[model samples]
Target: MATVADGHHPFAFTFGILGNLVSTMVYLAPVPTFYRIYRKKSTEGFHSVPYLVAMFSSMLWLYYATLKKNAMLLITINSFGSFAEMIYIVIFVVYAPKDARKLTVKLFGIMNVGLFTSIIVVSHFLVSRAYRVPVLGWINVAISTSVFAAPLSIVAQVIRTRSVEFMPFRLSFFLTLSAVMWFAYGLFLKDICVAIPNVLGFVLGLLQMLLYAMYRNRKQVIIEDHEKKLPAATPDHVKNLVIIATLAASEVHPVEAQPNNRNDDGDVNNNAAITEANEHEQTDDHRHVENASVEIQPNETPSAV
Candidate 1:
């Protein structure tokens, strides 16, 4: 049977094309985020490290594609990735704060320029041709694995906050799909170097999905917590009724202490005779009418004294 232009099986070529399409979407995922940065003329505290590292990854993959045979798909996709990542980095630097911009530039220089150059030179000159591809392959694999794991920080944030606000489900779903597609492409192409990293990618994608499931009801979590912290409410009318009832009860059976006649007779005698006589009359009146009382009905308004 005939094969594709790269001598790859038709299925492999088809999957590679699918992978390219999906990965392209993944690469462009930050377009909206960057567009906001541009519109506001500020990075809004977004980090450029992801884009910088992405650019370096694409560059390395592009180099590896050139070194290997029949890797046109890899070259093409990674070329676009490199360009896209560079554009993202540029936008980030333009809008980032001064200190952030400086740090971004330094990171770009060290990783994209210095480290990438060093890798190419060392691999091309020091390593034998037979071993160069494997060495580069391993390096790409390590970096790609780290890239796959990078979103764990996001997972951690979600778990800590008990919220999926930071983890968009669409992104997670597509990334998982991309991993599956690329894994099949690598398998069909019989490329272990391409296949290895995607295994980790798929695992991370599933983890992200699991986390999304666990925290998707973040609003409910917040509500439950808020309810737990909130004090129970008392109705205004109920509180008013309670105050009125208490006052009525207190008036109905007001307690009054009598002066100790024996021991405090001198103190009582110091008061005016008229005051003492009035108090005795009041005490006698209270005793006489103690059984006669007004009942406080719940529905009745309290009467003024």
Candidate 2:
């Protein structure tokens, strides 16, 4: 019995080599974030799913490489990938909250250990080496496809909040670029397994960038709305007048209040007295209102009046 040679072209080989280098760089890009987590002693709001999926992808690729002849590049890159992702996961677990740490441990058990062992056992016992390669290739395809779906949660968040604060543009840009490089490499190498998932990755990356652009300005708008809703304080003149009126009323009053007289000449002296009293009362009320307004402004200074 004879085995078929995996097709390889020079262009495809070169592309694959380049793609691997670029992918390695991108994979290591999370170093700064992990460093922060290490320093802070907390994972904050960061999720562990990306690192988990990345580890799973690397593991799948490594399995596929074992089945394929002359897959040195694949094995090399994915080995680095496995180490990087494991380190990220470890950092996350160290800094994550109790519930998050528990969840991450469970995920590692289910995905990395249990599921991976099952695949290895089944593939080794049931399949020949030649068939093993193809089976693992398809498995890699499946894992990568699922990885592409992970960004949907972020997309939904962006839509709901109308904010792209969590979705960094540089990340989307690099992801899309990495996907393109990998896709080209896979296409040249005639490896449909590698090319297909990257197509989805590229599309998702583009969508994320677009969403980021759309909602980047929304933060300013939200701040402006808050500013518009705040109340303006009363002017100083009213406050001063009220204080003066209250002081005058308390300190200087005529011994007897003058009475208004209305005669047949239609001169109503009482009306004048009533009007003057009403004016004085209104002046006091205005001062009281202004004083209340000033008091409500927590950090205001009297000099501001």
Candidate 3:
């Protein structure tokens, strides 16, 4: 917990504080996502890789700060990050599906508990004190850079779905800003290890923002093959129910729909269709059961009295 004097390293101190504030937001950005997971009592398909890797990155930086002199700022922020990320990972494990929860726990043990302890033991005993800083610095750089990998899943989702709903623009912007602040702090402190990985961070953040811009307004299409599996007593009802069944199943096969005519009428119609589809999907389970009931309803036939 050593610190530099007030006059010395003023720029580093100021930017370090800024970096801490920005990085704190970055760490907390996932809170709402996890909160939803908690409320729903399920992790859905959301991956735990990001939070786990983030905690490991924080641990590496915290360890490096301890070895390097006058790095109290690094120590303070990374400590919080480590705590926050661990809480997130734990929450995820608690709420995730049984198979997913087991996998996450296994990964956490292998990386955070096993690998981290191994690194500390080897560094303390095998490496000399003078060489420890540089050795750990390189390790920290590698770990820090891997923090960007957390966003890759979002990036992949954006590409696959052709929608930026998973990647918020504000998060990308702040991440870029945080990278700038940290890079400046590192440069002022003359710690290339601290600065270098942030260069990659900044670049990745910009890339995310760019992807957001590119795909933000793209049209999403949901295709459903409504080949009726259930027998309908009424022929007219069956025809009408076919279209509704397709709309209900649209949630499963979403795709990016490119506009063809690019005319006002076409635009209006497309918007209306998209809106109806979204609303239809909001009550998908109910609509599905309703459709099944419609298909199985018995028809009355007039009998001789």
- The best candidate by lDDT is 1
Better of 1 and 2 by lDDT: 1
Candidate 3 at residue 169, lDDT? 82
Displacement of residue 112 (Cα, Å) in model 1 is: 0.4
Q: Mark the 10 consecutive residues where model 1 has the least summed lDDT.
A: 246-255
Clashes of 2: 1
* Tens-place lDDT digits, model 2, residues 200-242: 9999889989998899989767434424542232334323322
Which candidate, 1 or 2, has the higher TM-score? 1
Question: How high is each candidate's TM-score?
Answer: 0.71, 0.68, 0.69
Quote the lDDT for 246 in model 3: 21
All predictions: root-mean-square deviation over Cα?
Answer: 19.8, 21.5, 16.0
**Superior by lDDT: candidate 1 or candidate 3:** 1
Error of 3 at 147 (Å): 3.0
In model 2, what is the error at residue 166, expressed in angstroms?
1.3
By lDDT, the better pick of 2 and 3 is 3
> In candidate 3, where is summed lDDT lowest over 10 consecutive residues?
245-254
Writing each residue's lDDT as its tens digit, candidate 3 over 1-305 gives 23462114789889998999998988888787778888989766566766777788889889988888878889999999999989988898899888989999999999999999999999999999999999999998887776655566556656665666545688789989999999998998889999998998888889889988888876343111112222222444433333222221101111222323455687899999999998888789788989977776488544579
